[model samples]
Target: MSDVAIVAAGATRFDERIPRRAEELVAEALLEAFDGVKGLSLNEIDTLVTSYFIDARQVAEEWIIQDYIGHIPRAAFRVENGGGSGASAFYTAYSLIKGGLSDVVLVAGWEKMSLYRTLMANELIARGLDVDFDFDVGAIYTACYAMMAVRRMHVYGEREEDFARIAVKNRNNALKNPKGQWKRRITVEDVLESRLIAYPLKVLDCSLISDGAAVLILSSVERAKEITDDPVIVEGIGIGTDTMRLGDRAEITNFPACRVAARRAYRMAGIDDPVRDLDCAEIYDSFDTVELQTYEDLGFVKKGKGVEFIEETEIGGRLPVNMSGGLEGMGHPIGASPIAEIAEIFWQLRGESCNQVDGAERGLVHSHGGAGTAVVVSVLGR
Candidate 1:
């Protein structure tokens, strides 16, 4: 086993239309990511990993991708873990390289959510949950988060505007990202007044259903230096799971999965105090309360203090968060969302992001699937 690093990272514009098929979108990201590798070529890649949740077309992800991308000679695999599938695929590539299974791996995550109607697409996403308990009762993902939001507000006496602040900050940050989906500058009042989807969750609170893809090229540290001088080392990778059904969980406000995952990530990264040690973070803001809950689960602040972190968590504040505008404004393409989070951090480390965190060295990316049932945390550094 040897050290592994992300030598290249890239993504397509997160819009409703790119005129490219889902496979083509992934190919485009692979092309852009390969460009970042100085001397690396397609021949150097030893494995290919891809993730897609809404591609109703049952394409053999790795096999078809190989024929399309010119990396057919290497080993290949497809990984799925609901919305966390992207990060999970990356983890798979990491395991292969770190365990001496393969040296260079091309990992990609993609989705074509815009192809289906809103109701049908959401129903497909709901299929990821346990069918017996959650689906039978008509519990969509947003509805579960709504329960969490309601419980959180009751526990802390927090206002709906507090959740609105999450939407506002992320949307404001997205204004700087040319590839972001939601770029409009909005206010707390705007969020509060928006049409409600579930109680306490407005249209602004949910992430966009997008058509996008992202790719990252990873290699052993020994091979990384030969490819690029500026490699983003994968310092710590932590992934965990909670009860598949929301009703089975004991607490709604705190994500036990995130609590366990973040601890492992911080420990592996040698972080003593995340609030002071980390330069920035990209938590899974699929909804406003999820991001707020992450603030507590990640130990950035004490429980119930997430609302207060909102004021100081912006671009120039203490430990700037969601520099990519997060899922709320960045667009949630299911499998592609976490990969976008990774791409944002890669840019921040390279000083290339539109919303770049000033002097960011050590950064964190957190994402979960189906209302905290599946979670992953990764710490990256230059």
Candidate 2:
């Protein structure tokens, strides 16, 4: 298998409106990336992989992009894995290159969610869950996170303030990021006072429903080095799936799929200590408590001890998680989110993050598809 590396990455300005449809947003991102490639063109891209969810108006597939965006089509397809679809799409592209089926692959993740009513979009998102068992029992995504947060508090003595602090810190980080959706800083009081969507989960605790798209150009390492000087190598990739129905899982405190996927990535990367080796991280933070739980599941801390990592001031506080402002402030455009996570890490490693991590050389990114049912982990190094 050949090494896969990201040579160029681009995204449309993450906003509620980009004055364009989903295909146009995708073309913008791809064109931005294509401009940076030294010897690559839309015609050179042999494989095209994209992710899209809730685009009810038209078919959201790679061929649709090829014809509408006027790209020279070679081979293409769409990947659907709920919210984590972006990362899963990257994995698919990597597999294509690894198997020697394609020399250059363009991966794009997009969603134009603001086009629909909030309630209608909510209903569409709710469909990602098991319809008969989970959705039928009023198990909306936020509601599942609320139940997990409640259990986490009961078992680990976590405070609602801890979740609020996560929101406060990520939002503060977003202020430095021009591309982030929620750039204004907010206090813990602001988060606490926000309307409660679920029992302990407030509107502030949840990720924003925004429209955005991100694109990454991945090629074999040889082809990548030919295109760009600073290529982020895909050192390791891992994916895992758990029980789709939240009630079927044994515990809600931590995601087993995340642990399994992270373990696989660490093993492949030969990483014994993620906290010491990894410079920064971007994890799915659809909810504040999800970030906290991720610290434990990803081996930043012991099981049920993730809350302490957030409270205590330590040198390596669980891998500097979510320098991107995460999904909460970074804007979660469903399918576009996971690719955006990788894009932020790419900036950090290159010392180009407007809100850059100091001297970051290696980073990890994790994305969850639906609730905690599907997950993908990837480690990238300079």
Candidate 3:
């Protein structure tokens, strides 16, 4: 048995359009991943795990990237669990090293979503839903989450202003991130005034459609020290899944799968209380409201207390979250987004984050997939 650690991280800017193809974007990220790595070469990575959605853009995309990177004959595969694909791929790579099946692995994820117009791109994303019910009824991804938001209001009396506040916080954090997408500082009033995409989810409430890629190289603890003196250990990883259709769910106010996943990861990481144990977190925020709901789901606060905890998530507060600007501000590029989350935590633990939380030693990442159908929670430590 072996302990796994992230030896390096890399990413491309999240933007409306990059003009370059997916393979080129992937190459650019891979090159950046090796920038500061010492005494290690590309050939040292034994296996590759890739993740991405939007099959319409490129089918079996990993093969093209593998060939382009000269790893065509090596061990490699692709992972897709909606938006959680990147974290799931990282989980797989971690398992390979922990199980002694591989010494070093590369987890790469990307999305070339800006190729189509926003409407078409969103329509493509809606295909991830239950085609028999939600998709057939024309439920866009935003609507899927909006229904949850409306239900949370009905059950917990949460206000639309609560959701807007998250948007303001995340977009503002993007100001310091050169690779983040939406760097504009906004007000809660601005989010409320934006055109409504659903009943309560406005245009600004939704994550942007962007294209980007990210890479993380994972190695056994011994191998990690060879590459970097300071390695961020993979402390814990947990995943959970639920039924695809929302109507079939027993409760819509909060995602039970997320709680289950969080519990598993916490138990493994010896995190009795997340707020007390972790320094920072990069939660999956495909939509601004999702970020708030995730607080209770991850046990950061009790149910309905997410609104109160918003202020506490600020830079100087208890457990600052989404210091990388999250999906809302960084732009959710499907496969690449979750990898970006871990990359941010990797930086935070290494004291390299643009929005550094001083003295950060341990961090957590929660990756939510397809309207909360699945969740992946991982704990990382320096």
Number of the top-ranking candidate, with lDDT as the measure:
3
The lDDT per prediction is: 0.87, 0.85, 0.91
Kindly list the per-residue Cα lDDT of model 1 for residues 152-199, writing each as its tens digit. Answer: 889998889999998999988988888788868899999999999999
lDDT of 3 at 249: 91
Best by TM-score: 3
- Determine which window of 10 residues in candidate 3 has minimal summed lDDT: 67-76
Q: Kindly state the number of residue pairs that clash in model 2.
A: 1
Worst 10 residues of 1 by lDDT: 54-63
Q: Estimate, for each residue in 102-202, the C-alpha lDDT of model 2 and write its tens digit.
A: 88988899888888888888888999988988888777888988999999989999988989988887777777777788868899999999998998999
Per model, how many backbone clashes are there? 0, 1, 0
Model 3 regions lying over 4 Å from their true place: none
What is candidate 3's lDDT per residue for 236-334, written digit by digit as tens?
Answer: 889998888988899888889899899889988999989999999999888888999999999989998899999988888899999989988888888
How big is the positional error of residue 371 in model 2, measured in Å on the Cα after superposition?
1.5
- Per-residue lDDT of 323 in model 2: 75
Per-residue lDDT of 368 in model 1: 88
Against the correct fold, how does model 1 do in TM-score? 0.98
Question: Which is the winner by lDDT between candidate 1 and candidate 3?
Answer: 3
Give me the displacement of residue 283 in model 3, in angstroms: 0.8
